[model samples]
Target: MDLQQMRYVVAVAETASFTRAAEACHVVQSALSHQVARLEKELGARLFERTSRRVRLTTAGEAFLPAARQALEAAERARAEVAAATGEIRGRLTVGSIPTVAAVDLPSVIRTYRRRYPQVRFSLRAGSSERLVEQVRDGALDAAFLGVQPGFLPQGVRDREIGQGRHVAVMAPDHPLAARHEVDLRLMAGEVFVDFADGSAARAQSDQAFAALGLRREVAFEVSGVELMLRMVRQALGIALLPGAFGAELHGLRCVPITDGPVRVERLVWSRFPPTPAAAAFLALLDV
Candidate 1:
């Protein structure tokens, strides 16, 4: 069987639907099915069990899946290596980010990369740090800027850090303790807290800090994005501890440094997979 057939098998197995796999592969369903059938015939064993509702991998299919994935990755690495050797990098680079990054200083770096590698394409998606880590580990993303607690990242994943920013207390300007230049966790202990959702990287850091101080938070709101959390803070819904990066645009809110709060860290993380030519080129630009 060919690489296309292997790709078809992998896609079909992943999606569990011929139609969905065909759509993902940008091919008609009939052609995809025909190719899979031909592959099975040549192999002398069925790879999938199809029903009206869903498709599943047969035992042989399960056995063959890993090799198929390896073959595809190998082919990808080969293509990337050749492109790098030729000094021409042109491909889609899917990157993920958290909402708070919009407030961080990043425009110049992005603009410089764009100017240097005009041929490289970029696709950015916003998601929770936990989800972004999952995507990077699964090879669905080239890399992502993620908030992670120290020593908490999964095995085989590597990170390039963007400093551990000082944590600050965010709240309405008129809220109690807002007039202070700095606040400690002990002072905010009695107030309602608005925080990142459970299992998020930011939450992990906050939780570790609270646990260290032997304090428990009365989380009034748990949100997915920094914007919503800030909105809540502005309305006096609760106080939140966020990184100083958010200090730039307070809008109707105040961000006071938490003298002893958790350090907020962001990292650019990538999978153990060999980088694509475009991803490598982009990474090279980061060194500047």
Candidate 2:
């Protein structure tokens, strides 16, 4: 039976008088009697015994009372939970990002989000751009900040250009490149380069820059992560052309300006999903 019908049955059973039950339910006694009668007919069991002086429960009425109350309670609870999840905006939000953006930017944003919306929980995953995009497309993640490849992104996903960064030269502190305020394409024509691995957006830009200059330098090493690439550079294995912010932070590595033809901009990309209150608040805190 419907919730309204169940409520009427519960109220009538509690009061043991149709007049009192109608008063409690804000309805007339005759209307309440009509509804309870309909319920009894539908169930093929009489729920009440009405005498000239009093009303009492039947054997079936006692058994059905608790179940009806429980069903109404459960329905109300389900409605509340749905409202809390969709209407109030509180739940676990799974976010993914590329390794570089995760390391450099998301920590502060996450901290602000947690501080503002303590009720919500977060799950962070880090991977390459391809992997993060795939997770977002598959609905495994709510959103991600991933580097975009040169080709097409997946369908149904949206992109926002947050900010841009560029590649710079990373060399040892004692290297000759450190002596110059800025280095040019001609000087780096023959230096050993520690390259980023395949399938990386940074690597593609680096390759394009080197190709336009007609430079085919030696590859001293190939590494996947920015940290590892810096570590290799710190050992003086070879100099690397890395993201500008990455080179700027190294302790012993001298980051020189690349006075080349053009600097490749590192775009901070985000998902098209409307930001949750948590995500929106976090993005607002970042405005300062």
Candidate 3:
């Protein structure tokens, strides 16, 4: 019923642990748990299923978190609007990005934004593109920088294409294809490959390229984190196809361009609705 109670629920839902949520909200664990329990009693539904291992949202919590988040965001927007009307732009900007976005110079962007609006605070969250997109849609994140393919964007979200690059192959120096500047897809068909998880945009593009060539990939490992895949490739477990700008120029490995595949575009994505003042300001600088 209260904003604090709603915030408590959201924090628990996000962190999946009462102790961690209490830490995030800067409250004592006992008080946070008491408030959430009171709210559940008022609503007459179990919000979370708690186990010794983790907390999971029940059906009711899943149905309620989005609207609660929107209410919180709307309250923030109202406060920001009043402050902005006084010619002072100050508020929190929640931003999400993928690990591969290290190539996008986000740190420089944040530094520049801070110089312009020192009153604004930023909280940066890192995750996969899929998780970022989900957060943006639910208003848990104000905006995000994502790696996506053209025309596959999530609904109710807008994106600006900032820059783009393509996938490349990396292998040990002693690998047969190391001497070559580029490697053909067919040449590596027989080799065990390290690749992204099937749900990732990078994996989708790689899959399409293989399907087009009528070749089936021999996936030895499918990992969610590209860093782990790079490590696997470096250790000679298997070759990997990764973004050309992944910033992993292994001295012991040769990086080569994939002869065919769709280009990976880096986009600045946000909800289509009005955003927080800090997020708006940061987004404005994205085009500059």
lDDT, each prediction? 0.81, 0.70, 0.83
**Ordered list by TM-score, greatest first:** 1, 3, 2
lDDT of 2 by residue, 1-288 (tens): 788889998888888888999999999888889999999999999999999888888999999988898788567545545646675545556777766562246787788677766766778987766667777666556677665434435456765555456567888888878788888767887788887776566576667767787876677688877778878888888888765665566687788888772344433334566554544444455551
TM-score of 2: 0.61
Please report the candidate that would top lDDT against the real structure: 3
Error of 2 at 198 (Å): 2.4
Q: How close is candidate 1 to the true structure, as a TM-score?
A: 0.80
Runs in model 3 deviating more than 4 A are: 5-68, 150-153, 247-251
Clash pairs (backbone) in predicted model 3? none
lDDT of 2 at 106: 75
When summed lDDT is taken over every stretch of 10 residues in candidate 3, the lowest stretch is 242-251
Q: How high is the lDDT of residue 271 in model 1? A: 70
Q: Report how far off residue 129 is in candidate 3 (Å).
A: 2.7
TM-score of the candidate numbered 3?
A: 0.80
Candidate 1 residue runs with Cα over 4 Å from true position: 102-108, 125-140, 150-154, 198-200, 271-274
Query: Which pairs in model 1 have colliding backbones?
Result: none
